[model samples]
Target: MEMNIIETINRFPDQSSCIAYLEGLRWQNEPECPYCKSKRSSKRHETYRHQCHGCNRSYSVLVGTIFESTKLPLTQWFLAISLILNAKKGLSARQLSRDLGVNRKTGWYLQMRIRKAMQEGEDVSLFKGIVEIDETYIGGKKANHSKKKRQARRDNKLQITGYQDKQPVIGLLERDGRIRLQVVDKAHGVTIKPIIEKTVSKDATIVTDGFGGYAGLSKIFREHQVLNKDKEQYARGKYHTNTIEGFWTLLKRGIYGQYHKISARYLQSYLDEFTFKYNHRDNRLIFDVLINKIAAVT
Candidate 1:
C-alpha cells in the first residue's frame, strides 16, 4: 500500500501489525536466521519469534537492521520514517520527540539511525551528462559574530575566524538527475578536482562558477563551462550553474530553518539526508523505497 502518516497510523495500530509489515518487507514470507545464514526457520506464532532449525537461534525481523536492539515499537519507527520522508525542510529531533511522545534524546537517536540508512554507498555509479558543480559554507553567518570575537579579529590575534568555523560543503548535480554532496575541509582544487574526477564521467560536461579550482577540468572532461559570476555573467546560451545553485539554496534553507544548528561531527549525516531526498525527489513511492533500503541495510 502507498503509505503516508495517516495510513501508517491507521494500518499499524499496534506492534504486531507493525512487526508483520516489517517482516513482510524484510523476509518476504520466509524468515531467516540473522546470526547464521540459515533459511530453515520455524515460526513461533504465539511469541512472534522465528526459531532457526539449523542454528537453533531465535530472531526477529529487526535482527540486522537499524531497528535492531531498539526498544521502541515499530509503529513509532514507521511514523518517524513517514515524517522524515514527507518533511521537505526536515523534522527536527525536538519536533519528532513531541510528535512521537518520546524523549528528545530518543527522537534524536531515531533520526540519526534513519539518516545512517540514507547514506549512499561507494559502489554507486558515477554521474554523467551535463553536471553542475558548486561549493557552499554551512552554519551561522559571520555577521552574527559576538562583539568580543569581532574585536579579536580586529586585534589580529585570533587565527581562527568565523569563516574558518563554517563548514565547507561541495555539491555536484547531474542535470535533471541526482546530486552528490560532501562535507569538505577546504574548497581548493586539490580537494574539489579529485572529487569531480572520481564522481563524474569523462564524457560529462562540467559547469561551475569562476573558481580557479575547476579551471583544470577542461583537460579531463568533454567540456568545462565556467560562469564568471564576478562580472554577473551567470548564464551564456545553454551554459549556467543555476541548477546547482538552486540545490545550494534548498540545502542552506533546510540547514538554517529546520536544523538551526548542526555540529561538525555529524554534518555529513545531515548532508546525506538532504542528498537522499534530492536524489529521490522524482520517486512516487519514496516511502516504499526508503523501507526497501532499510530492509537492505546490513
Candidate 2:
C-alpha cells in the first residue's frame, strides 16, 4: 500500500510491529534461518528473535539484510527510508540526523547503507525501441573556484576543463522505459560504444547529439540520428535527445543544489540512488519496493 509519514508512524508504532512487518515481507509468515537456510525455526515469544533448529543459531528478521548489524530500531530505519523516498532533491545527512535525532555519523552511515540497497544489479533486460544517449560532467564550475586555483589551471598545472579532472557521467534512456547511468573515466567512442552495444539491442534506434564520439554508432544500431546542437538544430521529427537531456538537468540540479559537493569515489552510488528513484517515480509503493530490494540482495 502507498504510505505517507503519518500512515507509516501509525502502522509501525514500535519495534515489535516493525519486526513483524519485515518478517511478513521476508518470510511470508514462515520464518527461515538465514545462516543455515532452515525452515525449522521457532520464535522466542519474549523477544523479536528466531532460533534455527538446524544451525542452533539465533537470528532476527533483520538478518541477511542491510539492517543486519544496525543498532537502531526498525522504526527509525523505516522512517529514514520514507524520508529518502519522498524527498525529490534528496535528504542530506545532517538534515537526516536532525530529523531522526541520531548522531551525524550514524545518520550518514544509515543513508550510505540505504544507498547501497538502492543499487540495481545488472539483471535487467536490454533496452529496446528508440533510446536517447548522452554524457555530462559532474563538478563545480571553473568560475566557482578560488582565484589562485584558476590561475594554477590557466598555467596548465591543474586540469580544470570539462574534459579533464571532472567526472564523466553517461546516460541512456529508453523511450517510455527505464534508464541506465554509468560513471566513466572518458566519454570517448572506444569507451561509450561497447557499453551501448552490450546494454542496447542492435535493432533499436539510437538518438544522440552531434558528437564525434558517437560517429560509429550507425554500424551497430538500426538507425542513428544525431541532433546538431552546435548548429542550433535540435529535433528532426522523431529524432532528438531532449529526453535524456532533461534527465541530465534533474541530476545536475540535485547534485548542485542538494549535495553541493560529491567525491568521484562514491559518485556511482549517488547515481544509483537517483536512477532508482527516477525509474520508480510512478510506483505508489516505493518504500516497500526498496525494502523488497534489500531483502532480495542476499
lDDT of each: 0.86, 0.86
TM-score of 1: 0.93
Which ranges of candidate 2 are over 4 A from the true structure?
146-159
Q: Which lDDT tens digits does candidate 1 get at residues 1-298?
A: 3367898799889989978877888788678787887999888888778899998989988877898888898889999988898888888999999999999999999999999989887778889999999988887777776888878887987665556779888899999999999988988899988888889999998889988878878999999999999999999887888888988888778888888989988999999998888888878787778878888745
Per-candidate TM-scores read: 0.93, 0.94
True-structure lDDT of candidate 2: 0.86
Best by TM-score: 2
lDDT of 2 by residue, 145-257 (tens): 88977888779876665556579888999998888899998888889888888789899999999889899889888999998888999999988888888888888888888
Model 1 worst lDDT run, 10 consecutive residues = 156-165
In model 1, what is the error at residue 205, expressed in angstroms? Answer: 0.5
RMSD of 2: 1.9
